[model samples]
Target: MHVVMTSAGIGRIEDGAVAVLDAPYPDPNTVIETTGSLDALGGAKVVRRIPLDGDELDLRAPLGRPRALWGVGLNYHSKAERTGRPAPDEPVLYLAGSSSVSAPGAAVRLPAEETVQMDYEAEIAVVIGRTLDRAAESEAWSAVAAITAANDMTARDVMKRTGTPALAKSFPGFTPLGASLLARDAIADPDAIGVRSWVGDERRQDSSSADMIFAIPELLARISRYAALRPGDVVLTGTPAGTGQDRDDFLRPGDTVRIEVDGVLPLTTHVRA
Candidate 1:
């Protein structure tokens, strides 16, 4: 089942329509709530059916108030090449706070100063279903509940000036999460999907997650060693090389950014001043 969090509340996509559940999940804040048993709402009937072409509901990230949002930097070979940095001995991790979360249709508010030089990084995000501590690499994928598309919008100038990406990365609405959360069973191979980003018609990133320097299992395993992985935690699997910074370009007000992974729904964000 594809789960979504909308202005109307938690919903399930069926028969090409979004059926609003009778009762929103008791904890409507995290994807973990849907893990293992989305059927918890089995007795609940659909209160309404919103057609896909109907006026779009205000969509929110499938997970509400995630306990932790972890971002991997330069995990993609292409990204490492573009940034002129060698691959790290270990994943370069950053904490993306819940405050940066935004729904698919939300506006990405740019700083008033045009010099912020915002850029977009399209990534495949994994949502954890169970708590994991020092999980074995072979067992990491088992802990994942779902996969979704995410756009890791960055403030390039701010990052360069501050010499820290996390500070610039945590701006409100910097993260535009997918509209649909596809359960793990739905994905044939989580590591082989295509991840791409576009600004209007300009394609900026086009690469597969298979090229990640550290695949999902290894990434999760390594991360688990550092901290406990709880349900509802999100792991952004890093972006490919085609960030705007690579082309000496950047996002501006009025631009629209679209990010997509092969198996999950796409996420679109409007850049606004």
Candidate 2:
């Protein structure tokens, strides 16, 4: 079953009545309201079935709101090699602002205060289904409910010059995520999915989860050791080797970025000053 948390409400796709699972923290509330039973609201009958029109409603983050936006850097072997960085023994993590979250089709702002080396990185974002701490690799799968495509837009100049990635990465409207959140069951193998990015009609990043230095399960296990993973928190799996910055090409105003991953919907947004 595919699920989405929109500005409208929490909805489960299928012939079912949409259950109101409280705004903002709907994932945990939905689980609690259903008493651990996904079908607790009665059945597919009770869910309010509404027609999905892409233009009618705005797609918020898969979760109405997330606690933190955690991202992995250089997890892809090819990406690490391109930047002359070693493949990390563990996930190289960073935090993007929760305020940076924007939906697909929205305009991503280029930070005028910063240098013009803005780049696009296509990644698979993991949406946590439940709160967990020190979770084992085998148990990590249970903690994730859905997956979506995310563009980890960055300002390479700010990152390299200031030596502070946070400044470059956390700009407002930097992360543009897609709408559809594919359920775990829909994705048979998370580590085998394909991810690709395109600038206009040109295909840029083409890679598979198989190339990840540290796979999703290991990343979840490693991250959970220190901080508690809460429901609705997003873990942005690293991007592949073909980022514009790596090629010394940067995004210009009016360019469109499209990211696609197998099992999830494609996300497209435009760049603007």
Task: Report lDDT (CA) for all predictions.
Answer: 0.82, 0.76
| Ten-residue stretch with the least lDDT total in model 1 | 28-37
Clashing pairs in 1: 29-64, 30-64
- Candidate 1 regions off by >4 Å? 24-44
- Model 1: per-residue Cα lDDT over 1-273, one tens digit each: 677777787887777788888774743334364544344544568898888667866567676567789998889988888788998899988887788988887887888663558989999988888777999999999888778889988888888888787777888998888877877777788678799999999888999978999999899999999998887788999999888888888888999999988866678999988
**In model 2, which runs have C-alpha deviations exceeding 4 angstroms?**
5-8, 12-58
lDDT of 1: 0.82
What TM-score goes with each of the models? 0.92, 0.86
**True-vs-predicted CA distance for residue 47, candidate 1, Å:** 2.5
True lDDT of residue 271, candidate 1? 93
Candidate 1 Cα deviation (angstroms), residue 97: 1.9
At residue 220, what lDDT does model 1 achieve?
94
User: What is candidate 2's lDDT per residue for 54-81, written digit by digit as tens?
Assistant: 3545455554446788988889999989
Q: Which has the greatest TM-score?
A: 1
Q: Per the 3 Å backbone cut-off, how many clashing residue pairs does candidate 1 have?
A: 2
